[model samples]
Target: MIGLPAAGDGVVHAVFVALGIAAGIAVFAWEVRRRGLHDDRLWIIAGTCLAFGAIGSRVGTWWQQVDPSANDTLAQWWMDGNRSVLAGLVGAWIGVHVGKLITRYSPSTGDLFAPAVALAIGIGRIGCLLTELPGHPTGGDWGIILTPEHAAALGGPAGVGLHPTYLYEALFQIAAFAVLWRMRDRMRRPGELFVAYVAAYALFRFLVEFARANSTRNRNRA
Candidate 1:
């Protein structure tokens, strides 16, 4: 058992999430400056993504439960710490299009946002690794082992070596960031790099789900 400290988990998660957002914005700004494109309209797209991403994160897992009654109320869901990154990405994708439509900025912003998104996910996942359910048992010597209290709180088993799925995701994101950074200037199209990154991540996440505690197999076993 890794014995993660459960105290102030929510606060720590929030802090890290904020840091991720700030880091993403900083990276975006740096990219914009490096490109030397002076279109103030890009900010509007960024703002729109932020607004929509927030909404998506809140509502993404709203229907995850088979029984509607088992789900959180809208108000509770909004106030709670729970979120869905996949849904948030979908929302941001929508936001980018809507922002471009509204601003009439025809250029592809995907390449600019790609690395930033990867870096943000890399940092944000640390919060999840610290506070959320680790994952299914590794059946091996290596893995996180939570305290009984923490395990109960996170809804996982105690005294078992659970897969550190979140850490795996964090590492994946970091690797994605590196790959994106290196390929940024080599893509034939402006948005091809972003598309490639998203596609790769989608596949990676699907495979990683097998080790995640929230997977259908794990839930059934639970």
Candidate 2:
């Protein structure tokens, strides 16, 4: 079956995204107050990062679900579906860079967004547990338990114990936040911190993907 085909009823993803951005804004405000980098322009930085992140994630998913090569009509493609997290991050990255061209924004802004995005993703992953068909399997030795029905909802084995990628991502995000917090004082450059953050996350996710049981991207698991 093609699953229930719903994007979670509670809008948890939306809420988490909002909260994560809010948290980032709060942190930015705090840093400005503390470091005396207080500038109205900082708000613009935060806005651009968060806005583009969302836009990127959405676009990536849209691209994945639409098989332009197979689907002929625009409406048919639109009605298809979306992609995975990897795709979303790619989308977010593309969106940020493109937005930079249009607005002439700086890459340094990524530093301000790093922590907030991490925090937001950690929380948002929780929502995925409650909504959407999770990438879980049938009974696990030490894994998540989704009903066969639920698994069917997400194209997975219902009632199996599958890898809790959401939890995995959440844990790594928390770790990323911790690392960023520790590096905050020593960070030499603005964009450097964010670059490190992204690199670290990519590595962490890739490592954890090794144990993932339901993914299709063997070449790039995470």
Candidate 3:
């Protein structure tokens, strides 16, 4: 039986997430330059999006942790917060529009951001794969089977194959990136590319959530 490794330290996950964010920002800057968008307001928009995205992600995770028994202090929650990618995306979208309204800069920047977001998500999911529970049972050999010790540490069932949900998401993001890259130039509308990417990702995420054991709706399983 193939064995999965134990979850890594929180610090490691944080480092990967930070790296992903930095890489995403770099990519966004590059794309902006390539498109000859020399708007000084772009940086302001990016900063706003980052700030709101962080807050939204943390809030979303905290909301999802609906366990009544888990009585964590506010400081503890802030220090070691869980985050949601979906929430971050939503927050970033809102931030971008709000920033634009504030700066009165009228241009479609979605095409520039779509690929960068996909790349960032793909990189960040690597950390999730390394540190979080895989997902629901796969009921097949073609999945990650965590060792007894590792499973115990993660409070998951041992000696069973589970879906590598994070890996699936990472692969999906990569594919989405490729598709967005190819379709960027073909999009007739300014924001169409980003809209299409977001729609595709939302559908993917919705289907994938069904295979998540930790999903709130799946908690009452036999």
Candidate 4:
């Protein structure tokens, strides 16, 4: 695995996250405007979703690391913790619904958000590709091969090819965005497109986890 020059000090993740949020919001706003559904309350909903999503991602990461044998302190966990994009999505969904209820807005904004979310996720996963562990061993030469030192740094098998899981996910999200964008206007229901996107993503993520080393940790321990 070769380190990205721009990922110095691990700030690439934060930079990409901010960019993702900005790009998502920009696309969402454009979609809302194009669909003639512009409303100030949507911004509020977006803000709420962002806040909750951040919290949920943190909590999800903490949940994954929860172990009685670990001697890490709360401050350490707070300062340096893992996160889950799936959990963030769940949190954002909840936030949007709660925001809708609070604002008494009834129209389904899912169609307006589907493409934006997909695109943002696609872009964000690039950061993951650059900064995070690649994935499980490939046992073949047809994948990202890491040097012994790099493999050790990422806790992967030394001098082996591994699945570029984040790249796979990024490509999937981009493809999903293209598909959803094309079908956005054809969907009869306002939220059906979003539902389809979420379902597809969930299925994809579940399948990809099988190829992820971290996903097998519990089984390995057992």
Q: Name the candidate that leads on lDDT.
A: 1
Per-residue lDDT tens digits for candidate 4, residues 189-208, read 77999999999998998999
Alpha-carbon lDDT of model 4: 0.74
> Taking the tens digit of each residue's C-alpha lDDT, what string does model 2 give over 1-222?
122323344456557656766775677676667767656655554555555665445344443435567533545433433425565566556656665666675645666667766776777666564555445452445566656555544555554566666667888887888888777778877778779988988898787666565423211112
- lDDT (Cα, 0-100) at 15 in candidate 3: 71
**C-alpha TM-score for every candidate:** 0.90, 0.74, 0.87, 0.86
What's the lDDT for candidate 3? 0.76
Deviating ranges (above 4 Å) for candidate 3 = 1-3, 6-8, 61-76, 215-222
| Candidate with better TM-score, 1 vs 2 | 1
Measured with C-alpha atoms, the lDDT of residue 151 in candidate 3 is 71
lDDT of 3 at 67: 77
lDDT of each residue in 99-208, candidate 3, tens digit only: 88889878888888899899888888877777677788898876777776667666677778889888899899989988987887898889999999989998998999
Q: How close is each model in CA RMSD to the real structure?
A: 3.5, 5.4, 4.1, 4.0
- The model with the greatest TM-score is 1
| Full candidate order by TM-score, most accurate first | 1, 3, 4, 2
State the C-alpha lDDT per candidate: 0.82, 0.59, 0.76, 0.74
- How many clashing pairs per prediction, in order? 2, 15, 0, 1
Q: Considering lDDT, where higher is better, how would the candidates rank from best to worst?
A: 1, 3, 4, 2
